[model samples]
Target: MTYFNKNMPSGVFKWRGANKWLLMLLLISSNQLIAKDINLATAINLMLKENPSLKIFELRKRSLDGAQYTAGLNPEIEMGLEAENFLGSNPYTAFDQSELTVSVSSVIELGGKKDARKNFASTKYGLLDAQRKINSLDLISELTDSFIDALATQERIKLAEESVRLSEDIYESVKRKAKAGAISDVEVKRSFASLKQAQLTLKGEQSKLERQSVNLSLYWSEKQPQFSHLSGELFDFGVVKEIGQLHQNLEKSILIQALTMNQRLAESTLAVVQAESKADVNWSLGVRRIEESNDAALTAGFSIPLFKRKRNKGDLMEVEAEIDSSRAEQQIALLELYGQVNEFYSLRQAAIEKFNVLENEIIPALTHALELTKEAYLDGRYGYLEYSAARADLIQSKKSLIDTAQSILNYGVQLERITAEPIYNDTAQTQGGDS
Candidate 1:
């Protein structure tokens, strides 16, 4: 391995600190915005900045850096002095009992091993950074999914309410006709049955909306989670980019990026394991003083390993196997992401097509049919069964439209999460004319 000069930019040292700071700044600024309405992106940015999990990862990255700094420092030098007294006097001559001597000692690295340690530490730091990015991306995906679910639940509630309204209209009409003796008691009972079914459906939808609201409140403010205002009107889908083109741009995909970093980290780890097997030499120097003779002595030492049986034959193989495993996993992750994106795109295409047909053709046709059926019933030509069927058909069609719209929004969210890019040009956009 090669070493980079501390003063120069190196291949392994492209400097992640500057870029990390920019990401931090972006998160911080987003969190500081007024808490009016939290969009999906803003909520994620805020969570990244403030979440405890992300903060822990940030601290872990810093600790690894500290380790690198400590490993890169040169071994320290030391000095000492010693003195002692002789208890007995000499017969022929007098000897100095107390004397002091000073000596200096230093440890010198015997090989280019200090640099190797530094390189290994740097590799560990790089791995920590990669892990941090992975965690951040994961958080983003979860937040997006949760937000979309809340919005979809809100739309479903609106459709349920419309169904209830239709049921109420039928119930009132039948009750009036029964009072005039123009309809049988059984017809009035059927209308009451329909109204009860609709009310039950409305109740179920209301409960779902509340549950979804509670789910969103965990990540966002209470006001933001209560998505009661979303109408069954068409939601803005924003600009539609071709799914094929987006799949081709999978290089920017988040899961792929994480796996790629993991592969590099595994390779780096293998290198570290190999480097560890190399022997290290430690040298030391010291001084010693004799109390009775008033004499001084100096000492120096060095150490070297004589065997590497365990490291070379056992631990090294383990590291090699780990690297191979990591490579395989990385490849697998990439394939899975590719397949998932394609599936989501296909579903999105189908949902969009169905939504279009319903909105542009089926819904309008159903509306006209309902009006004509009402007029026919008033003219006393159509039976109760045909009129009731038309009403139910219209209700079912509106429900289908709402469901398809939700599916489209959900697929859009998945696309954004997988790609790590905004699917829509702006957040305020509705799909087609629905928004």
Candidate 2:
């Protein structure tokens, strides 16, 4: 079975013969299965809870949380025992002549390495947190787009169905006129052709809706959609923010914030590398046994690595280079974000203008024209060809209106994705009203 078949309710298909009787029996015994209704809020909540990618980021955040503790920890103590001179010369053969040494040692960090490490880890943790937020924003953006797509598909299906109905009506009228010798068989055939085209369009739209349904289900890692349909208005217009306000709000965007956090993390790592330039001191304390004198004494010493400058210079350079790279990336991201906001804002305005013209002018005119043509055809003043053309025009105009409305909603979603906030908010309305 196809993915669509698996997801679809069984009630959609008819059973044959004995299976039909069984279906009737079952239907009589219980209520029919209905698809669940899903809204935007419910869909987003499900994605947040069940999206696989978001869960991966959540696990990473937890792992980094544990790593933060290890970052600031000191080195572990060490212990050693030696019988160094026992195996040398004649004394090596005698246990009494053996010199034994036992010691404990640990490195004491210098140059504030511990503090630097802690700061670096803290910065890294902050970066991870920002990354999680970025992932969340991305998921939400994707889900929002998919939801809008599903809604558009629903609208398209409605338009297609209406077109099919209009075509069927025209075909029936053409047949009636042909039988009365008022129209030729050629006109009836043209009507039939238009009907077939409308049917194909409806079928295509139905297939698109199924695919869209599956796409929405994928967001929550479901094999099929839980809901039969989405519930929302397609042309529900909301307040749009000013361009300046949207730019200012870009700072709160997860992408931009993550970039800033990355820059800070690089700088913190540089500090850590610099702190490591001063080598830590390895100090040891021990008790030594002198075999000849049969006496014990305490010993203590410290050691440090040489060539610190050359050893750390490469790391310092690498970190410095990364800092510069991060800075450049941040600048690029800012420019790209600005461009995205400007582009979507322009497209949104254009869509709004187009939708207004179609909704207020073109659609109504086409609808009225189609109605007049239908009446004229029924009264023998117009022919089937004229009626079919008018019907097709009306259908196309309605589809165009739907497309424009979807464009406006999609552009709004794109803008919201970049800003990490709703561009259309109550505040926009309040401010605009006051002005």
Candidate 3:
């Protein structure tokens, strides 16, 4: 289940930034700094080029290549020599009547065992290739989630700055009113406390952003982050397909395809084991010399084991069970994946609904209400309490919008990963050099 995958020779991860692996190599070799903001594509590029786990796939692939090579080989011929009728009874004492023989021998494989071996080896190699790709896709999905988290923190920092400014303006207004005896000292202290809280929140968000940035870089072992920021959109989750259409395409995803490969590999292994059940024919040809007759002749012999199939019953049974297990595992994976797809889809829809309400209705209404309340407070038509409530409502709604957008993006990433549906249309955020 934890099979690792890597970029194939064709570099198929173009969209995931596998094309940038070479560029990453150059930068690392040159000791050049990464000054660009990290994004989805860049993060993938770094993971492909620098992650230790990814490199393991390439090495394992090379080992399977060797297995495929060995599969094509034929049985080796062996030579033997024997002498008889020497140093025995009186008539056959010494070498007086000894018969000498020289022979070349080897097994003649039966039951197409050679071909079965080749097929099994090739299938195993191909299965490894398939697993590598699926693992890569999974890795990219995880990295996307982390990148979105960092981007979300960045958005929150912006919201926090706005909150700080609003808090400062309210505090100044409250002080003016208090100086004129329009409000009590209690209101002044409350406004001052609100300003300090806003500042503290802004500082906390900045620190959170730094930590998230470091987390993103950890995918490639660059724990000390090189990028100043992550450049993906936190609010824009692009378009989502109806769950039905997306689910329909799930079978074609690389993840599901890998299951097919597993089944094929298991079946091929059964073929190899079944072939082994029939022992190969061992035969020999030789030249024999008879001293008594003073003549030479040709001699041949062969060996075939009895009930050879019974010897391999255990192996055949194991392989057959593996095939069945593979089928069951595929069904399990599909079920789990489908469940995840539905869950993420539902979560994404709910988050989107909340975001739209804030973006299109609630936030606008709150902003307008805050403005009116501030004017009323200045004109003595409303109290400082009303103005404070209005201001708090607007700020809280704005922060909620950022949080909800993050949720949408995170859920979108999960959907894209399982469904192979592109939901985060923020690819334009990738930058190579400094940004």
Candidate 4:
């Protein structure tokens, strides 16, 4: 304390500026570290390979494989040993009182029972496989949705930035005019308010973009989080105009494929029930030894059910009911799919038309109007309020364009998900058919 004088530059004081510079560098590095960057295809691949649900499906497939193997094997193999007093009263003389017998039995299934069982297992396995594919398609759909959300948030963030820049420009203009006595204090105040609002909007959108980026990172490569912005051109909005075979192409939908597979599974189950109604034969074999004899004799036998409870009717009816339910469900899913495709297509079309109008017509007109308003304000032919309103109209037009672009992309993603195809893939042909 005695050495610390007012004129002396202490060690801490000397390093304070360096420490602040280092802190600033650290913050910039931290921001760079947390940014999430992703591309569309890479995101889809991650969802397929890295998702937890896909792992579950793989485990289920392994279990079904085991069951399928077991179904194809023989029913049972039996072995047994027995001890008995073969002689009534004679003991240890010519004939001993004890005897031992061993027996073994193995079942041989007939009447296509084993085949039916194997087929049942195989069908179940096929259903699971189809289920796995459905899972993939579903995951892809979720990825598409997330990807679109990220893109939309990104576009919104850009628009927000633009608004902030425009606001700042307008504010500076008004401030200069006020200093030159060409405008009143009210004009500067209004410009300041608009600038502040723009800044707040930009901050809010940036925060939302950060959240969407975090969500997107879950399905992307590890390096995606470091990306701060998208680098691709925005999707052009328009109809393909090759919509002539729209109804025919509906057959390519993932929802339709899943429904069809489910219906087939129901039909296979009904076949299993019908196969179960038929009688099954059982067979057995055994060997016997007597104390009086030195030889052993083998016996073989087969038996068929003479009569049993006729539960086949109820079982068949149950399977039939399931088939009926599956059919109904399939129909319902088809209807919903059709409705969704139509709805999204309509929305996409409208968004495209609106975006086109804004980009080609509205934006140009707004710019002209804004320029005229600015000139009028310079010549004192317009009030500050009128100039500000015209400027706002231009911003609004740009915002509308951004919103329409986002809407179109959103609908495109939805269509892609429903169809299980790339939205812009022109060469993909439909597969599968009506059952």
RMSD of each: 15.3, 8.0, 12.0, 9.3
TM-score of each: 0.75, 0.88, 0.81, 0.80
Ten contiguous residues with the weakest lDDT in model 3? 426-435
Which pairs in model 4 have colliding backbones?
35-225, 35-226, 36-224, 36-225, 37-224
Q: Per-residue lDDT of 355-432 in model 1, one digit per residue for the tens?
A: 888988998999899889877876777766777898889878877877787778778777876777765644455555
Clashes of each: 7, 1, 1, 5
List the candidates ranked by TM-score, beginning with the highest.
2, 3, 4, 1
Q: How far is candidate 1 from the true structure (C-alpha RMSD, Å)?
A: 15.3
Tell me the spans in candidate 4 whose CA falls farther than 4 Å from its real position. 1-37, 83-100, 221-224, 238-241, 292-296, 422-435
Ranking by lDDT: 2, 3, 4, 1
Question: Residue 398 deviation, candidate 3, in Å?
Answer: 1.3
Q: What does candidate 3 score in Cα RMSD to the true structure?
A: 12.0
lDDT of 1: 0.69
Best by lDDT: 2
Clashes of 1: 7
Off by over 4 Å in 1: 1-42, 75-107, 110-112, 221-234, 290-294, 308-313, 423-430, 433-435
lDDT of the candidates, in the order given: 0.69, 0.84, 0.82, 0.71
